[model samples]
Target: MPENTPLLSVRDLSKTYQAASGPVEAIGSITFDVRPGELVCIVGPSGCGKTTLLKCLAGLLAPTSGSVTLDGAEVREPPKKMALVFQEYGRSLYPWLTVRDNVALPLKARGVPKAERQALVERAVEEVGLGHAMTTYPWQLSGGMQQRVAIARAVAYQPEILVMDEPFAAVDAQTRADLEDLVRRVWKDLGVTVLFVTHDIDESVYLGERVLVLSSSPTFVQEDLTVDLPAERDQLTTRALPRFTELRTHVYEQIQRAKRGEAVAATP
Candidate 1:
């Protein structure tokens, strides 16, 4: 791979499930790339295989056809260079473990040294503003704080890419907004490539440098809209701005089209 090549790439990726009812295709052929340090969001209608794509990218589920590559190597299993955060924070974090312990588990799995793991865990928790809750268990924290601990754990792993699967869907609106901002801050500060999947058009537009819209079931890429807003996005001011509104409207329209099973143009 060239130095400037994407840290992760997907080509003709598809997933199918065999049920007693017969074969069910979840995702159809789709291809895209996530360049180093880029924040890309995938959005589509419910049951459009957004989560399936994330699973394929994370190597949690093998695609029925096509391929996913990480750092120019075909991803056959979970890559050490990638970390995933799911929608259910409660299920994702271990209730029996302290926040600090949960955050440090990935490092431990990777066999990182004790001193280095401690430092990384501390830094990640501090970055996510969960330093005060480090000793608390997941059950003791609010929904938002639990999610932050989950994110802090992913970050502590120091993965080259961070994949989030509708991570804010379980939180209240206010907490969701704060978590979105927190994700952006961490993405910028860490300079890690991010692949986020969400059903919320506004959320995708607000968070992504490029928002990818997928077609309905047996999904494929429908559109990829580059968010042309300034790098520093303020939730209030940015959302109220003309450009942000325009971008959000574009993604919203595309998603509406997808829900109707209409063909939409891909990003230029």
Candidate 2:
């Protein structure tokens, strides 16, 4: 695939649900594109349809207007080449299955041979730093380790694009920081196009190559801001950088502005 070509394209997409009261609009014609090998984060105020937009992109929900395409093909249903990591690690993993089994399930589902699935599960477990706990059950491991298993499962899928909807939201602050670094390393080493949705301004600046800010209720794309930070980001050095502070501040103010219904600058 061409580097300049978009791996995922979301064109004028919006979602409305038929509710008892009437039609409740979640997103209002939002548009954006994520190029191959890019890590983009979508940030917005609470209840701003971030999840709705993500669901549309994931092909788990049909949009009321516009479209979502992956690799030039329209996304009508969940694409096999894509993998999703949700926030709830506890419910994501099976309590009865060992970590290795949990990580191997996706490959098995895809009809991969037992030998190939074992190899993939081993690699993914090592990649997520969970090799030591592979034999343990989900209930036996810590929250962070369980999430690592979840991540390992996604990695083992060998997806072209990985979409995460607040995957680390439930972890502790320190664990969250560690997982953030882990994601960057995984993205770099695997070269997977990542679309990470988060509510944290600092995290958005820390992780994204570009941060797409969404407007409040009846959401739309308010801004498409490039992060412009070094590709090799660290929790300490990157967060301490002057540019990092500036970008986070800019995204922060944009969320505040969106809450207040003020006009937001498109891109900067």
lDDT of 1 at 181: 97
Cα RMSD (Å) between model 2 and the true structure? 1.6
Backbone clashes in model 1: 0
lDDT tens per residue, model 2, 1-268: 8788999999889899999999999887788889999999999998998888888888899999999989989999999989999888899898989999998888888999999899999999999998898888999988888888888999999999999989988889999999999999999999998999999889988999999999997888899999899888988999999998889999999999999989553542
Residue 211 of candidate 1: its Cα lDDT? 90
Measured by C-alpha RMSD in angstroms, how accurate is candidate 1?
A: 1.5
Which tens-of-lDDT digit does each residue in 31-54 have in candidate 1? Answer: 988899999999999999888898
Compute each candidate's TM-score over C-alphas.
0.97, 0.97
Error of 1 at 52 (Å): 1.2
